[model samples]
Target: MSKWTERMTDLIKSVGGFAKANKPVAEAFHTLETATRADGILDAKTHELIALAVAVTTRCDGCITAHAAAAKKAGASKAEISAALGTAIALNAGAAYVYSARALEAFEEL
Candidate 1:
């Protein structure tokens, strides 16, 4: 198998084990998954794409890699992936700037 496939398999195994060991965690995962499915606001592919964007913005390497792979499998093209990443970066930058400005105000008041 390819390296990506191997890594994904390992990740799945790890998460599965964790879920099996922790009832609360397992329940939470199930609940979230069910809610996402029931919401139907976005298709699976779109949801995966959104996940990829959020992972990129949050700088979660593992999540980014996994979601990118999932997005590809869900029929997202390279161009789409790139666009999503760009959007994520823009949003992250804006959010950081806003937070930093607020932090500066707080610091000045101290």
Candidate 2:
């Protein structure tokens, strides 16, 4: 299997094990997912694209794999996914810039 395919398979199995170990939390998360999907202005592709961006921002391997698959399933093109990832990269850099200023201020205060 390909690297991402294997990772996704492992993620699925791990999630199942987590659900078995903690049904209530898993159920709650499922409920949240269901609620999010129940009704929303954004189309599936848009939602999945946003999810992919967030996954990149958060540096979550599981989320990246899952959302990449979901985004593809939702008909997000590679260009669209790349654009979303670009936004994530920009946001991370912006966040670092803001935090660096804050760190400098803290150092000055010290």
Candidate 3:
């Protein structure tokens, strides 16, 4: 198995233990997650890609691994997943770039 695959396996086992110990809370979370992830305007594949992008933006390794696996399972090609990651990178960089303008304005005011 790939490193990510192993990591995901371990993470799932750990989370499963915690969920089992906290069944009520876990079930509530599961219900919420399931409902939110259910198809609406977006298809499952597209949603998985979006989840991957959000995971990247949030710097959550577990989320990245989980969503990458899900995205692949949902038929997202490597190219499509890569594109989603690229969008995350660009948005993060763009946010910093835009904030730099504000930083400069603040310095000028000082």
* Candidate 3 ranges with C-alpha deviation above 4 Å: 101-110
The TM-score measured for candidate 3 stands at: 0.82
User: Which one is best on lDDT?
Assistant: 2
Which lDDT values do the candidates have, in the order given? 0.85, 0.96, 0.92
TM-score of each: 0.84, 0.97, 0.82
Error of 2 at 15 (Å): 0.4
Provide the lowest-lDDT 10-residue window in model 2.
33-42
Which one wins by lDDT: 2 or 3?
A: 2
Please give the distance, in angstroms, between residue 60's alpha carbon in candidate 2 and its true position after superposition.
0.2
Candidate 1: tens digits of C-alpha lDDT, residues 1-110: 97778878887788788888997988997798679769788987888888999987788766876887889889998988888888998999999999999999999999
Clashing pairs in 3: none
- For model 1, the run of ten residues with the poorest summed lDDT: 56-65
Q: How close is candidate 2 to the true structure, as a TM-score?
A: 0.97
Candidate numbers sorted by lDDT from highest down:
2, 3, 1
**For model 3, where is the 10-residue window of minimal lDDT?**
33-42
